[model samples]
Target: MVADNLKRLKDEIAETASRFNRNPDEINLLAVTKLADVDMIRRAYDSGHRDFGENYVQKIIPKMKILPADINWHFIGHIQKNKINKIIGKFALIHSVDSQHIAEAMEFRASNNDIVQDILIEVDSSGEIQKNGIPIDESNELVHFITENCPHLNLLGLMTVAPFTDDRKVIASCFEKVRNLRDGLEIDGLKLPHLSMGMTNDWKIAIE
Candidate 1:
């Protein structure tokens, strides 16, 4: 069942990518394994899936210890400053960097380890009170701060979480806003290459 589900998701992702004239390979299929156990993750790995995202540092650490070293782990959760040491050298990508304080702590940790850390700036495009992301207006300053002060941190791109709504238009608009924000940053000489938007609920609309 896991293998079937993985194949179906990949197939759907490919079909969605085609609709936008995008190469499906360019769209990374990041399996959210936050709720899955070691056995489930191993099953996904055995099925040829490599990139997996986990929401908590504590949960991901144990999985990383047992999982094949080739699997790329992405930290896609809200980062707490106290846990920076736990996540810095472990995950291949950190996707929820929402503030300068977190970024600086990550930089310090990465520098100490002599590794360059790749991360995405999380933006609150939906303007939700519950979300953890830098406001869209303050994102530029955060980008500048990372680029200027954090030598060990590589700002890969922007990430946003759209409000879970039945309205497809709202979802599309949120994704578009993040994409446009990325483009605007590029225009200003910040080379952001990835836009980590969308999730299980509205990924198809994200591809569109």
Candidate 2:
């Protein structure tokens, strides 16, 4: 069931990319394994899936011990200051960095380990107070801060979540804002090559 689901999801992603004239190869499908069972993960792995996302260090560590060594683990959850040590040299990418404090803590940990941590700045373009992200207005400052001060941190791009509503227009508006934000942010010769937006709910709109 997991293998079939993964294949179907990949196919849909490819079709969406084609609709936007985007190369499907450039679009990475990160299987978020927060609720996935070990057997389910194995099924996807057997199907040639390597990249996986986890919401917490405690959960990912145990899974890492049992999983193959080459799996690229992406930490896509809210990062805590104290948990920085657990994630520093482990995850291939951290997708929810929003504050200077978090970035600074990550930088310290990465510098100590002599490793550069790749990350995406989470932006709250949805204006939802309940969400965890740097506000869209303050995102530029956060991006600049990471690029200038945090040498051990690689600011890859921006990530945002669209509001949880069935309105396609609203979701597309949120995604467009983030894309435009990413474009405008490359001012000081900074190139943000990725935009990590989309999820189970509104991923198709995100591709468009």
Candidate 3:
């Protein structure tokens, strides 16, 4: 059943990408395995899914231990300062880095481990008070700080979470805002190559 679901999701992604004249190959399907158990994740891996996103540190650690070494783990949750040590070297990409302090902590830990940690700057594009991301206005400064001082940290791109809503216009606007922010930063000379936005609810809009 999981394999079938995976195939259907990929098919949908391909169909959606085609609608936008996009190469399906360019769209990476990160299996969000935050809720799935280790056995379930292994089954997904067996089905050829390589990238997985987990929401918590404690949960992802054991799975990383038991799973195949080649699986690409993405840390997609709010990162607490105290737990930075546990996740620094383990994840392939940390997708929720929002503050300078967190970036510094990641740099320190990755430097100690002799690894360059790749991360995305999460932006609170929706302006929600509760979201875990840097405000859009302050993102550039954070990016510059990471590039200039944090040698062990690689600022790959920006990420944003849109509000879960049925309003298509609202969702599209949120994705566009983040994409534009990324583009604007590039104009200023930062070479950010990834834009990790969207989710199960509105990924098609993100692709467009």
Worst window of 10 by summed lDDT in candidate 2: 181-190
lDDT of model 2, residue 164: 94
Could you tell me the C-alpha RMSD of candidate 1 in Å?
0.9
Native-referenced Cα lDDT, model 2: 0.91
Of 1 and 2, the candidate ranking higher by TM-score: 1
What does each candidate score in C-alpha RMSD?
0.9, 1.0, 1.0
Winner on TM-score between 1 and 3 is 1
The global C-alpha lDDT for each of the candidates, from Candidate 1 onward, is 0.92, 0.91, 0.91
Which 10 consecutive positions of candidate 1 have the poorest summed lDDT?
58-67
TM-score for candidate 1: 0.98
Task: Give the TM-scores of the predictions, in the order they appear.
Answer: 0.98, 0.97, 0.97
lDDT of 1 by residue, 93-185 (tens): 999999999998999999999999999999999899998899998999999999999999999999999998999999999899999999998
- Among residues 3 or more apart in sequence or in different chains, the pairs in candidate 1 whose N, CA or C atoms overlap within 3 Å are none
List candidate 2 segments past 4 Å from native: none
What does candidate 3 score on TM? 0.97
| Tens digits of per-residue lDDT for model 2, 120-196 | 99999889989999999999899889999999999999999899999999999999999999888786688999899
